[model samples]
Target: MTIQVFLPSQFTAPEIFPVIRDSFGTFSEIPTEVDFEFSNLRFVRPSGIVFLSNVARYLHRSGCRVTFSGMRRETNCIRFLDDSKFFEQHIGQAICEGSSPRSTTQPLREVRHEQSHNWLRSTLIPWLSISSQVPEHDLYNVQTCISEIFNNINDHSSQDVGSIFAQWYPNERRVIISVADFGQGIPNAVRTVEGELSDPLAITRAFDNEFSSKSTPRNRGVGLFDLKQNVVGRFGGRVTVHSLGGAVEFRNVDGSVNTSTYNVNGYCPGTLIDIELSTDRIEITNGERESFTWI
Candidate 1:
């Protein structure tokens, strides 16, 4: 049987969860074909972009014949999708033709485990240089945090490729970066080592500085911990992780750590990390810096 899903006009985080739940339900029924309708989609945030791409990737991987239709031209929605290569990644290149001229206003790209280093050095750093006005020294911290996230996907997840979307809001002086992977999520990964654990507890433990699921001699579990410290503790931003059926959000506001976690209606099936950094708060003072090198 064929299932037709209509996307919302304004696709943003928290609000788009309903669509995601419904889509997952439809796909779980093992539909012969899935058609995504984008006729009314006028605006989409970075989170929505990642969510949509991840969903498409998931559906495609699940042996469903997926097709996209009803994408209206002469709209910011179509332009954003075109520039981000969303159609090419999710649907196909043929459908992307005459969609719209690629928008240069934001930097959004996909990252693969094999090319993580190159992506960091070439795409991410250069984009930060122009968009955030972040100094060279401070760039190391950003690189370290993001690199850890990528490494986690490589080391922990079953999937190798993931989507990354970033946008800088000049008026707000903040940059939002979103990364997503369609893989075995945090809860299942942690359960392998720590025995049975709830999704929320597993996500919380995954961020602990002493938690590592690897059996190697040097398996210091500081990736997520250090990411939280750099993005939230130091930069005074927000870091959110959505894995499986649970979601956790961390924010450092007024020098205080604020965190919240809740359960979603349906499982995410993978992981999604959303980070927001305040450009005005990031101090680029001259000081001793750690070697900004990575494999």
Candidate 2:
């Protein structure tokens, strides 16, 4: 069978999940030729980039012949996708002659699980240090957020690799990154402990400070509590976690940060985390930062 999936025009967390859940989520049942149409793509963020790329990968791995269509039609989004190296990373070669590692953007990248730490230490942090002028030591909170994410992928993703993309907005003094892994999912993992909660509830529970972690000794993670602290409390940015058929968004509204959850169009097969950090608010702490104590 042949399947044609129309990607959303506004490609963000809200827009992409339904397309993912309806088509990519059920690809294996038919597993024939699949074409992902990009003509309708109007706006895109880090979430769209990582999700589309990873979904293509998942399809390919499952023995389906996958093709991307509609690139010939030109739009600003087309230019952004090319410059971000999205097409190149997806197809294993440059789709357009490109200039990258720009002051405002870091092109799409794939990080395998075992090399997560080194990628952080050697590549990502250094580039972040240079681009944002935030210094390496001051980026530990950022590191903690991503490290905990990687540790989550290691323990729950059921896959050895994940993908990441980042964009910097100096005028806004913030950087946004999205990471994805094709594994079970936050809802699936948290359900093992919480037992049969809804996707949104399970995901919310995982981030709650009172929740207990079940990771192995080799992969210790305090779950999303610390991630929330680093991103919202420390860096003054928003963090959104999307998994299964639900998503939870945490951001500052007025002077207080609040949590909210809702369901999306379909289940996200793996976990995709969107992290926003305020570059102007980078802080270098003295001694050790306090860890959240489980209640």
Candidate 3:
């Protein structure tokens, strides 16, 4: 399920270009070859090969694996590729060949969430008509679960600095959603009140029934607590937390516990909330989920 590009010698000049970097965790791994039985390659002359190499490098950094396939073609193309590299570190790299084109001229769309939980409210409103079971009630429960987590993020994590990405798979009867942030993490959030504290201790307090670090509000901060209920008590799913150098997992009806910090990194500096909803009852904030009802 990948593509590779080959390069000839003309495209291998080290002094010809500058290095490029990418954020958004897109460029992390470079694949020597693809894993699919059948694959596609773009044959290019020296110039094309250079273009392909830059493109492959760009994609490779963007969590994509790309290979170069042809390099021994004509010198004119190579000359063009080489000439272009002289002026820019990442000339053609800014735009990947055969990659999704950017519409700089197009306007961006905006979504608003006025006091509404960002994820659930936007997802459930449209999935109502496609559910074969639970329907409204199931949607409500899912919304509640999504709301609790989103609210926790809003209240505890940094705003506009985090993002939530969701995908619903009707054919597979699964919905996966992840909310992540790049801000002060759980341990740091707690230290604002309890001074310096150990990662394990901070994580343990997060679920200690009567523990909370919210100085402004007096509620036990039931958002995480309630989210755990929906995952374990209601649906046959699991809940996991990876932060402050520790990892915790809450099992289903089996009431088992799995804890490990063997290789846990420093405070997440961000949070990732992942949920899998398997019931046919499908509930979402936006109508987008209904698109797959035919499956």
Q: How many residue pairs clash per model?
A: 0, 3, 24
Model 2 clashes, total count: 3
RMSD of each: 2.9, 2.8, 14.0
Predicted structure 1, TM vs. truth:
0.88
lDDT of 1 by residue, 110-183 (tens): 67888987788777777776777777566777877888788788877777878888877778988888888877
Query: Which has the better lDDT: candidate 1, or candidate 2?
Result: 2
lDDT over C-alpha atoms for residue 19 of model 2: 74
TM-score of each: 0.88, 0.90, 0.50
The runs of at least 3 residues in candidate 1 whose Cα sits more than 4 Å from the true structure, single-residue gaps closed, are: 26-29, 94-107, 217-221, 291-295
lDDT of 1 at 191: 90
Return the clash pairs for model 1, or none: none
Question: Candidate 3 — what's its lDDT?
Answer: 0.41
State the weakest 10-residue window (summed lDDT) of model 3.
Answer: 101-110
Off by over 4 Å in 3: 1-119, 122-125, 128-134, 194-197, 218-221, 253-267, 280-295
Can you rank all candidates by lDDT, best first? Answer: 2, 1, 3
lDDT of the structure predicted as candidate 1: 0.76
- TM-score winner between 1 and 3, please give it: 1
lDDT of model 3 at residue 116?
Answer: 42
Stretches > 4 Å off in candidate 2: 24-30, 99-101, 210-221, 253-256, 284-295
lDDT (CA) per prediction: 0.76, 0.78, 0.41
